[model samples]
Target: MNPVLGQVPVYNAYGSVPALPLGWVENYTPTGQPYWFNTITNQSSWVYPMMTSKKIPGTNWLFVLTHDGYEFYYDRDSKTSVWEQPEELKEAMQELKKLEEEEKLKKEEEEKQKALEEEEEAKKALEEEEENKKRVLEEEKEQARQEVKRIKLDQAVDNAEDVEATEMTEEDIMWQLQQMAEEEVGMDREEEEEVQEEAQKEEEIKQVEKKPELSEQECIEKFYQLLKENNISPFAVYSVELPKLMLDPRFSLVPHNKQKNLFNKYCHELGEQIKKEKSQNTKKPENEFKELLESKVTTKMYWDDFRRKFKNDPRFKALSVTREKEALFKEHIRNNLNKKNPIEDYKNLLRHVKEIQKGIRWRDAKKLLEKYDVYHAIEDKDKREDLFRDYLDEL
Candidate 1:
């Protein structure tokens, strides 16, 4: 027994134990020894010369046997050793190792594929979620737009109803016509009385100037001089004096019809003269009445007061000449009454249009001017500018 194997008893057949094996070699030596130990027992043993010893053909270890059988191999380079197992066990272990490696590789590939699939699933889910959100937002926007459109449409309907509500009734038209007829009848009576009184006064004044009454030509020359002196319309004079002229003694020899025709001819000539002289001062009563209407002067009382105040003015008389004319004038004014834009807005728009006009944008100016009835009468482009300046000065 080798001293390095430690002191231990060796067992033989029949369980007889001894301090050492029966055929154990003592002080053993060999020509070439393998640096090896029994790996299973972690011990080195002595080899007996009588036991068979064979050198493994292609390895460094010499296969040796001792009286007690045990086998192991040594690595020449690593100088490490392992016990030899049974042939069946060795084959089974080799197969198990190969199978483990193949299973490991397959498991790794499966894990990688799973990860790729999970990533794709997550991306698809996120895309679907985003698409749903975008669709929902679009739906919300469309709903909001529809709601706004509905509100605007409702507002338009309400405005149309309001406009319709403000329209004049048939009763109002009849009332206006009745008032106009009454005012015309009163004006006619007053005019007839004034004409009679004026004729009486003229008879007394001309009684002393009867130095053989003036000829028709001289009478016409005097009439022209009177028109030049008095800046009055021919219609104003014609309404009162045409009949008087037809009955005057200066035209007694002339047939009554001839005198009437001559007076009409002179009246037309005087009208032309009046037109030339008063054209600059003439204003459209339609426009003036529109202003008064805007001022809330809609009653017949107001109109009658206006007529009494400006009775001497030919323009006022012209406007009130007929009930039809008066009704049309009021209708024109009512049609232009914009309940939406108050007087203040009208003034402000007038100023804004003026600024546009200063830049020579006449077409744009005309469009704005059309909103107000008074502006329609401002037909002349230069006159519109003057009106703008005058209104600004007033402001």
Candidate 2:
């Protein structure tokens, strides 16, 4: 009797494993047994012989071969190694072979089941995709059919008239069309001329009324009211304990942008300032300034009173250019001088002395500049004075 397998250590099967893994070894030895190999040092050392095996189909034995060494004997009848083999290995070997075969069969069945499931899923998915494609195509065909029907219906319209048999001459029809176009163009042109003429009249009226000078005290009061509405706080009293209020962010007279809103906030701030001043004045004995300032916004009497309040005051002192010969000579002097860079009171007295020396009346010089656009024409100071002096002398 010959035995191909032994009750050997598990390490004896490592030669059957293929190659190295990156960081792990293949651990395919049977459980609960260990094996050892002899090192390259001794000649009489016995080793678990390396063998390769395959089934000779429909036989009770498996064929065996050594791993390139010729020490082992081959037995063709039993299909096992004959040398250095034991009798106790037959049952263990048979059990191991049966377990391996059962595992392989189970794995093959699992793979076949997995493949069948995958194929079933793929078939169901394909069927669903085909159904969706059919539905989309059906909807597209239905929409195209409806569109074609609508076009045909429009072409074969209801309440349409039949063609007339009478022939139309091209020359007469063209003449009629030309006459109609001329009449329409003429009507449009006349309407356009009328609109333009009306617009021109309105523009002329606006142009004539465009005087930069302050027209009335009502306008002046409105200007002050507008400033107060924009929340422009006046300068405060130099106090110690009170929180200093900042000027409102809204009071640029000639602002870079947003003049309208700034004007509105300016009025609001000034109104608040007036209210504060009024509250302080309520404690004082009868004051006329607060009363006049608190007067009605619509009152013309307030303007007259305001005019009277400043009348004959030194603030309105007959300035350097005061000449009484012209009716608005005082106003003329006030108008021509830039309000921002006003002449000092002492400087006005000197200019008055110089004007008296020129022998041309001072009022006449102020009037000449105020009435006409003299600023554009006048370049030379000396020449202007000479011409102005001549005009005043003639006056």
Highest TM-score, which number?
A: 1
Each candidate's lDDT (Cα)? 0.53, 0.45
Best by lDDT: 1
Candidate 1 segments exceeding 4 Å error: 1-84, 165-395
Per-model TM-score versus the true fold:
0.22, 0.20
Quality of model 1 by C-alpha lDDT: 0.53
- lDDT at position 182, candidate 2: 75
Tens-digit per-residue lDDT, 1-395, candidate 2: 23455542222322365332122222323773434333332122223333456553344445454444423333455444444444554565677579779989999678556645654566587679968976796687567656755764565344122435566589857875686577567756765786688669868977875645544554445545544454334432212101111122222123323333344555567678789989986643222322323442121122334346654543333332323212232233344433322323223333443444445464665554433222313434565555555544644
